[model samples]
Target: MVGILLQPQSSPFPLLFLAAVSPPLLPALGVFSLIIILMAVTIGDRLIVRGMNRFRVWLTPWFKSQPSPWLELSWSLLQWGLRLGLWLLGVIGVLLLPASNPLQRWLLLTFTPVVNRLTSLLVTPLFTLGKATITLTSLFTLIVVSLALLLLSRWLRNWIKQRVLTRLGLDRGNQEAIAGVIGYLFTALGIIIVLQTIGIDLSSLAVLAGVLGIGLGFAFQQLASNFISGLTLLVEQPIKVGDFIEVDGLLGTVEKISIRSTVLRTNDNLCVIVPNNRFLERNVVNWSYANPQSRIHLPIGVAFGSDTVLVTEALLAAARQDARVLSHPAPSVWFKRFGDSAYEFELLVWIDEPKDFEPIKSSLNFLVEQELSYRGIEIPFPQRELRVRHTEELRLLFNQPTSPAPTSPQRPSQPPIPPPQAVQSSFSAPGQFAQDQTLRVLLRKVAYFANCSDAELRVLIERGYQKFFRSGQVIFRANQPGDTFYIILSGSVEVLSEGQWSPNQAETPPLAVSIDPKATFIQVENQVLATLSKGDFFGEISLLTGAPRSATVRAVEDTILFVVDRNALQKLLQEYQELAERIAIELAQRQQVLRELGLLNQEDESNPADKTPLQRIRQRLQTLFSLSDRPGWPGHA
Candidate 1:
């Protein structure tokens, strides 16, 4: 080959060929080659430096007085320069190939010439304006498209979050996760399109994709499972936000659901994070799943001797009366078990909503206590009886007579009974009657006597007698003629009606009402009105009835009573007709109020009602005063 090249040709073909192609191409090709190298070095360095600077400046704020616009401009310039430089380098690299490489040379000659012509045609007009109009137009278009895309993405996200997810009742956590997923999907598509526009080939991506898939599968198995589970949860909706659930013994309200986990806020203000897969595997109690008609089971126990029927009725009444309790499915009481000292009963009541369960349960407990107390059903405490050998001293101390002994003459010589004037003055002194003000105040508080003046109340107190009785002491007997009304001052008293009465048989025997000091007990005819306590009063009703006692009263403990004699009341009525009339009216009004309040039983009585002397006088006054044409009494009219 070397010898053939050294030998001279007979024809002039080599020289002619050199002259035709080589001379025209040498300078142009050399100039193009140098331009290519210069552009590559300069543009490539500019792009790399600009990109690094933009990133550094964007990420670090320490060097800038004002940074936001600078950072954005720098980033935009970096992206534009990098893309433009890459295009220029590609065109230059193609043009630099030698003519010996026929395929590459032809391609460059054909396509590069057309590309250069188009570039010259496009660039000449833009440069004639003395500005980078093309670059500016491109940047503006990019900015506008970016802004439009950003706004469109934001609007779409908001629509999905509010209109879509909210309608589905998805939590914010789930909404954010879904929005992120959508953004990532759109970003991936945008990147592929951008790569294609930059003349990058994706034909080689299949192998890369296979490798990525295998790597991702190995690295993110749990993540993949959770993501799939989250999609399933969204589709199936096994549990939702705001659901009260019990999972693995953790009872709480579901606060959020995300791709990886679910968050629950417990009743005690604890936040519990449960894995999505774990939630799918565990058993959950959804309190509000089908309906929020939650049933409350209240367990009540009463003393062994209590009347179960009465207890059941009272409990049912209590449940019915409560507004929170549902009425359609009526309340039920079952005798649960017999315990050591009490009969246990379960009171089952239904509520309309799950959220109301706690409040209803609370109100029911309060009502149960009140009802049991009012009906005299004993709620026994845990108690044990201990037997002990009693010594003589113990017996003597316990059995000692509680009543005060009379003053003995041997102790001190007593003065003659003081004159009525001295007695009255001594009793009315501030020191002598200071403690009596409490009793005076208590008497005024009695609802039946609330209308009485302070002076009249004091007179009543002055006339009242204090009596004490030990436990088991009989204050009065059943069927005995009612002589006087007794007010309990301290301790408790039991009311016993004759066992022969059928209605009374169903009621627990010897119904006791606790009577602390300052309580008044009244002996009324034909009815056991009430067993009174401190700040309680009675016996005005007795003035309405002129018959004998209906039930016996016995002291359940050491009890003190403030008793108002019937005869004293009769005298007081005679002296003050106006006061008596006012008292009578007050009593009647109180009874009417009690009946309206549902505190008194609704029943008809067979006994004949008697008109008090004050009532009759009031009738005469009304007749005399006569506002109507018929001159009828006020009540009679």
Candidate 2:
């Protein structure tokens, strides 16, 4: 047996002596030694793997750019490479043992045939591509290179999109559209280039590609249409990300535009995926298209006996009180068909921002109800009167003789009408109209002065003077230093802000009107922000802060306004400290609201009680009007 084990090798060394002693023991001992070596290899590989993981963890931060797909790929490759190297070293160490060693001899005898078989297996040709015969090795190399190139291309694409296009000032839609197109082109070109590099001629695959394309076209016709439609939307800008739109009664804002579909975020926070072709084929209402301004209609009703003129005035006042309503297109009241119990009227108003229509309309409804109630107008419910003739009653009446006409009770006498002179005096004076009394009534209706006492109102009536303005006349210009405040007594005036007039107001000079209303006085440059009807007041901020007029005021129709100089307003504020606090609160609230609506330009959104509002008012009064310490003025030092 010893001779038999020694005869297989030329120089037995360690194995020869062991086999010489006991041949049967050599096999078991060789197997035990192989198991021990395998255990060591596994243990070493695990330790090495742990070390590689630690190294990778340390190396990760160097490539810290966001969305780093390449970094991830590189780390994976590093781990795999380290594992492969460690395994290769283990195999080489096993192979490097002395020829006489039992472990080395056992390994050679066990794995040499397997290695030879594997090498031969790898060399065998799997298939041919064009003129190139692909083996396992070449196929693996091709796959690796292709994956690397694809990863590099993806990294390049993202880098260009975020760093390059963003810096070029392209809008989000255009940038995404361009990036998508480039990514598609790069993928297609990369595949073609890679195939050619692998010795596959592109000309040979045209037949197969055409057949596949035709098959895919038939299968994905709608998909192709949607993709094309998405491109069209991006190019035409009919709807964009962040645009509010309504399609098939689904109201939502566009969140994302992809090749085959668009995502919409509804007001309820639900995400809906809509096909791009749906937008192209169906009617889509884009509220933000061209401009954000849109017209809204609010339907109202009043008792039939209510004064129509008074109802119209009340409706206009309700609309004018809301800041969202645009003044350029002054709200109009249209009398619809008289209903059974009430007269229906529709108030048409234009809003600068389309999104505000719902809330503004709701607020207007509330205001209309309050105004109608205050003016003694009733909103009647639907009424119907029915007269029924019962069959039994008719039969009884015909059968029996009627007896109700025998005796009737006497009715009370009606009151006699008063004389014409007494009636005329009761209604109005012949020549002397109570205009002053009317002015006082109008002042009482004004919201800003609503809290004033009757005596305060009397003082205002004594100090105030009425000014009449014709239609299309200018009342005040923007940015002009103002010391007077005015309250509308009748008719309507437009409050035009300076910056929002026209898109090209600065580039294209305003058209020279034949007769400029305020053009004679430094020219009126403004956009109509709101309309103020009777009981609406302006220049109150000027009274409080003594700042320049922030907006221009123009008469929308023949109007009358009672003008009060700065002195009177100062006295009113001085006498009533609570009124000043209320004014501050209202002004701060309005500023906050305007900031939310993007109308006011305030830097910080701190707490409302911060000294900003009051300090600003006092600073403006001191700086603009140069108010010194005085006896009556409380704002003075």
Q: What lDDT does the true structure give each of the candidates? A: 0.59, 0.68
Cα error, residue 502 of model 2, in Å, equals 41
User: TM-score of each candidate?
Assistant: 0.35, 0.49
User: Which one is best on lDDT?
Assistant: 2
lDDT of 2 at 40: 69
lDDT of 1 at 17: 28
* Tens digit of per-residue lDDT, candidate 1, span 168-285: 8866546655764575466557655644543335665666678798999989988888877766665566776667777898777877666677888886788898877866777877
Off by over 4 Å in 1: 1-222, 267-272, 385-637
- Runs in model 2 with CA error above 4 Å? 1-161, 320-332, 351-361, 387-486, 489-637
| Candidate 2 lDDT over residue span 1-637, tens digit each | 3223212223222342334324544454445554565566567656755675676455444222343455456546655566556556655554454432665666578889999999988888898756777788778777777676765565565667678998999866566667656766787788778778777778768776888889999899999999899888877779877678999999888877767899888878888999999999999999978677788989998998876756766677677778788765556777897998899999888887665567888999998987776666788988899876698987787899666776668889989999977785686323433334344566666556667665566555544555789999988887787888888888999887664233333454353344333432334354568998877778866665555777888898999887877666665655654555555556556675445434345554465754465555444444444445343234544
Write down the TM-score for model 1.
0.35
Q: Against the true structure, whose TM-score is highest? A: 2
